[model samples]
Target: MSSIWRTMRGIIAATALLATGLGTVALPAQAQKVLHRGNGAEPETLDPAKSSGVPESWLQYDLFDGLIMPDGKGGFFPAAAEKWDISPDGRVYTFHLRRNAKWSDGTPVTAQDWVFSWRRLVDPRTMADYAYFLWQVKNAQDITLGRKAPDTMGVRAVDDYTFEVTLASPTPHFVTMLHHHSTYALSKANVEKFGADFVKPGNLVTNGAYMLAEAVPQSHIKMVKNPHHYDAANTRIDTVFYYPTENQEAELKRFRAGELHFTYEVPVSQMQWLRENMPAELHTAPYFGTYYYAPNLTREPWKSSKDLRLALNLAVDRDILVDKINQRGEIPAYSFVPPNTTNYTQQIPDYARWTQAQRDAKAKELFAKAGYGPGGKPLELEILYNTQENHRKVAIAVASMWQQKLGIKVTLNNQEWKVFLSTRDEKKFKDITRHGWIGDYNDANNFLELLRGDIGKQNPSAFADPQFDLLMAEANTTSDTAKRATLLQQAERLMIEEMAVMPLHFYSSRHMVSPKLIGWVDNLQDHHPSRFLDVKP
Candidate 1:
């Protein structure tokens, strides 16, 4: 039998055996004793600088310790650094490292490890997409842009246990940024010993509560408690097994069979069935993410006419899309900035809102103004979506809606997730592309600043505007919360007016966890299976 089939059979046999002979293996008093997480994609890499996908990042958090860590309440707390001091000018930050911290290999972790990691991230040779995250560090941008050498980075090891960093400006989210995996320290010894293979499963050394014990590409990964961790006592789980299963049905079957403990990104079609049948274990959270369609503004047709873009934007029925197509808990989005971000207030005007009649009238008017009307001149557009079954369903639904509402013909192209990401970044195919962005930090700027003309180059679509860029720049420097919110709101308005991107919905993640699992907190932004917090019975 195939390995997958064998595994499935093994799970069934184990459950039956447990019921028949409870005395063979002592059952713990608590409910769940192990956490089995399932994901759709396998991690690409474990190296913090090279990792990009959610799986890799989530795993990195378990195997590495950052200077700061998120407290699961949208705030920062010390991790490797026991405490810190900020200069009155908000330019310099001094961190006091825990003297007892040690790497998994038993070597003491030092301030120099952090300095090395920071310098490596900004190195041009690294080609790290997340390098921009370090822009707040003094001379980091210059180093990344090749204007300054990597050696000139503004981090210094004051001593074996002290580190100092200089920032170019007062970044309000500076402390939070430290919690990101990109800011985590790497062992120099491991890097030299393993060379380019430093991040390979067996060759890795971690400083966090858990250490990577096994990695089976495209299959599963397993982690065990790290005895060398500073706070190992708080880590209750002995081992964590993560399986990569792309099919939601398969995941559900495994969960029901007691082979898996938890699964996320629940299939929209199964939400009703799970809600009714498994209501006790179902969990949902409003995620800080935006699903949108991107138009290749650098390409033809979409390039010359802003009216056509606005017309297409207005044609999308976000309410219907979120309610019908995205049955898996999603909020219809009217703006890019998700609600509840820091400094956000409901008083901020929502520029994307318009009455149904007004939207239809405006769409019709723009279509006619652009020399195209219903059945007059059919605009042939290609829409790209990932091969995930739910995403394909959404794409087909949206395509049909556009054809029926605006007489536009859209061809849907579904590709594997990895290929889809590459093609989108290359800007090679399709006029419209489906994409989503989950917040990196709980800040409105993270969403609004991504649309800046220069920054848009990093994004898939080539949409840009000088006015929007200026507003984003001003918001970054403005310390006053109200003033900054105003500037960000203005920038959001510009995006809506131009219709450079169409906001579809604010995603809400749904999942099922075994009743046995405890201390598993739900985080919208960073949805990692936090092993340290979970206690298995």
Candidate 2:
């Protein structure tokens, strides 16, 4: 017994030495709680300005934090900015940086760093898709449009630690808008020194809970806790490993094998099995997002044919999509906006209430009017979707429905995430595309603004309407809550009537969490940042 005890003590002492001395060595979970998370796809870029996907956003949440972080209760708390103040009119905001907040290079995070980052986000050279988000800030849109110089924008560094922002209008949700990853500050010195290569793992200077220790494409991305992080002493998980798991079945297998602590999403086909077997681990709840199929309206033959767009939308069997394919409690979506949006009502179109048979008949009639039917040109098209098993299943099911019901010839085109985004953004695809948008903020504008003409790459459907835009613009800036709601409803009704997209279903987040993982709480946003998650020792 005395010899065994001595051996155990030596082993424990050596393990401690390895953890401290070998910085990149991954320690056992018993000694250091490491989280292995299964991400859905390979992240396109870690550069916050160039990222537009959920996978990249998840990494950003840990690798970089903005002025304030969401508190998960429809509120926020200070992050890089230790405290803040708002003006009486709510148009101006002031942020006080934490004195202890330092970048990975041991440099203090100053207010000037934020100004440079914000200006770069809207600069035309950067080509950031989320640039529309900052239009609320004074002169931000002008700078983005090249009408004004970058430094002329509203954000200013009052001092080394003080940052002030003046908005174009009294935006009540302006502070909420600041919580997005796009607003996260990048070190000016680092960018000036490294240029485009700054995003490389070794060159990146992060100011969050974790730093990019290594990234291996299609395999795993390894991140270690940042010693310079303001709250590093309080952070629970010492290391995080994210795996690119596009295959749901394979991800589930790994989970059962105890290789993964969490899954990005569960396979819909295995919903029943998960419920019966991993009831405690299988979590399904309402998510603030919508899944839809959009037609490219930029060029023919979809360009001059509104009837064709309406016909395609009517032919879709949304009920089957929700109840059959995605059976994890997803709601059949009719409007572009999710009904979960606070204090807002979804504008359900007239065709939504019609039975499948009724919709099919109407679709046939519309197809005939649009110069396609049994005696006319044969209707054929393709749907482009990113590489995912669930998306493939949905494309196959929906194609069958169109072919059998409306005699429309349909084909499916699948591409990896990065390629698919480029195809969709460039409007290179001739037919329909499957797209999903998870809300960034709780407000209705967060979802509705995607269809705006000036939204850049996000507006893949080419939905441009002056009246719709006018209504939304007023709704976006109005201080009167009642008037804003009315305007938003009008814009949505108009867009739905115009057939901007075929709404399939509202997403219900279905993920598997290991029992060993703690501090897990379900939320509508479906955001679980690493700082709040922990692994049991």
Q: List the residue pairs that clash in candidate 2.
A: none
- In angstroms, give how far residue 284 of model 2 lies from its true place: 0.8
lDDT of 2 by residue, 287-331 (tens): 989999888988777878889888878888888888888788999
Mind giving the per-residue lDDT tens digits that candidate 1 earns over 362-385? 788888789787546768899998
**TM per candidate:** 0.90, 0.94
lDDT of 1: 0.78
RMSD of each: 4.0, 4.5
